[model samples]
Target: MKKPPIWFWQIALLVMIFIIWHIATSPDLIPPIFFDNEYRAAFFFGEPAKIFNAIWVWFMSGEIYPHLWVTLQETLLAFAIGTLLGLAVGLWLGLTPLASAILDPYIKAMNAMPRVILAPIFMVWFGLGIWSKVALGVTLVFFIVFFNVYQGVKEVSPVVLNNARMLGANASQLLRYVYLPSATSWVFSSLHTSVGMAFVGAVVGEYLGSAKGVGYLIHQAEGAFDINTVFAGILVLTVFALLLDFVVTFAENKLLKWRPQQAETETT
Candidate 1:
């Protein structure tokens, strides 16, 4: 018999998980071993079918698009601003030892501080708007990209630097041709993580204080004790996050094509 492809197994695994979840959560589907009451499972974990139906109804009614758009806007804005700032600061410090040394402790301290706590302050400062969400997200994203870019720049071989200098490469030329390309890889790597952080920041901000966005919807559901709607909101956010990750993967493949393939290296 022919072996199934990887995707087939992947989908099969997903189906199996759903089956188990459905069996566990659906009333009368299986005997209630833990809970004496049949409706207990649905009350706590929620029925998958009800969650799916809620999501379907949300989309069919065109009720989710505006909230989804707001979340995406906040996420994208935060990611862009944070990445640019991180890249600039990383490059400046990585290239200049004195500045790096001077700012190192402050940078470390800021990074060490639990940033989620700043959400309330940001909400106060930015007034429970998208900017507050974006601000929180920037804090989450900046350090990840900054450290990666710094390490990438520092990891450039001295031999390569010396050779470029010997070939009469000026500081500007070297930075443009060498350092930027080296850091580009690290930036892309950090971007995947940053995207998730951006979403988290946005959603958390909405959760803290907002009248709109999926987080607000989830919060509303929670307040009303609507477990299925809460699960539906989470499911929507998760699918969107995966879609954002897919976009990042596509961009990475296209941008990093100049890098050697792992399969080629292994074959060699």
Candidate 2:
């Protein structure tokens, strides 16, 4: 037979994984070799069929939308605010050697600190609302963007800088034409990772304490020993995270159209 397309293989792999998971967790299908009871596997790992059913029930009941919306809102706000702040600060420090030197240790210290530890502190400061989650996410996202932007600005070609200066390019003109483009390119490169971090921060904050969010749903499920529902919540979050990453990739393609295509480079 002719070889299948890449997507077909990819989907086949995913289906195979689910099939194995289903078999491993189904009490009737798998014997209780590891556990004393036949149902122990299903009780602990959960049945894939039941997990899918739980997810279907959640969506059909329209009970998951509010939680999803809350998580999305927190992630977006954190991403936006963190990116802006990081870009601004990175530009300022990247362009100023003296300030950069002075603040280097402090910046490193802050980045080194465990950001998850700040979630509780943020909860205390911002209360148990979306703002707290947003704050935690900002901490996670800010450093990633900041470091990328900083490196991008610092890595600007010295030849290009000299040429711009020779052409009498003013500070504002250099920043607009050179610095911003370079920094934004790096920002886009890190966008996917930053988005994932944002999601993690939001969910973790919700898991710790919140009235609404997919994380809150997972937490509640855990409390009730509802492994199926917990897995359902994780599945929903994973799907949405992939969707968000797709959106980021779309935006990157649109914004970076000026960059040479990989196929064209390869052909050359």
Candidate 3:
């Protein structure tokens, strides 16, 4: 038996989505159901065309790039800082049992709390500028990578560690040759997820308080009752999120080439 190429399935899925969206949103395809003088069920269910039109307008007008760049900047900065901190902390804690024991309760308490609610506090401390958004994003991204790397290092084979130690491997050699290699997959796995979380944190921070970023644009559109534009802004954020995820995936593939490749999983 033979299977279709993976890209063929991807393209087919995209085409099917386009077809359904076009059919559902075409003005001539369905009649509007009036809910009230001001509300129409069709408007709610059939806004795909409107959303696409708004996106077209944005692209043609070239007004979206600046906002997109602002959001990207915040997301990237936060991702870098958060991932670095997570890697460092995860390694340190994984290597030092005493330090891990001392910080366990405090770390758990902080991670357990609703971090987003701290946005206002962050804004008060860091202002409504990009720093606040980056701070929020860093908070979101940090714990994800931290937990994964911590677990990854912990999961290193005891037999392997014993053999290395018996062979006279020092602390630095064990970390370099054993812990990092063991944790590489876990780090990349968390990184892919952290990318999205970082973006979400940044955008939500912008929503709460910001003069710029795509989230602010979306917030403005909603206040003006421009549903189409709001949807367009959402679409822009989703596209960029996918782009960032793709970047992480590429890095993971490059870094974890020693890992066994798995069959592609079905995506909903």
Q: Largest TM-score belongs to which candidate?
A: 2
Q: What lDDT tens digits, residue by residue, belong to model 1 across residues 226-255?
A: 999999999999999999999999999999
lDDT of all predictions, in order shown? Answer: 0.93, 0.94, 0.87
lDDT for position 209 in model 2: 96
**Distance from true location, Cα of 49 in model 3, Å:** 2.7
For residue 15, give model 3's deviation from the true position in Å.
5.6
Candidate 2 differs from the real structure by a C-alpha RMSD in angstroms, to one decimal, of 1.8
Q: On residues 1-268, what C-alpha lDDT tens digit does candidate 2 reach at each position?
A: 9988999999999999999989988888868878899889889998899999999989999999999999999999999999999999999999999999999999999999998998888999999999999999999999999999999999999899889988999999999888999899999999999999999999999999999999999999999999999999999999999999999999999999987776764433
Q: Once model 3 is optimally superposed onto the true structure by TM-score, how far is the C-alpha of residue 139 displaced, in angstroms?
A: 0.7
Higher-ranked by TM-score: 1 or 2: 2
TM-score of 3: 0.86
Worst 10 residues of 2 by lDDT: 259-268
Better of 1 and 3 by TM-score: 1
Q: Report the number of the highest-lDDT candidate.
A: 2
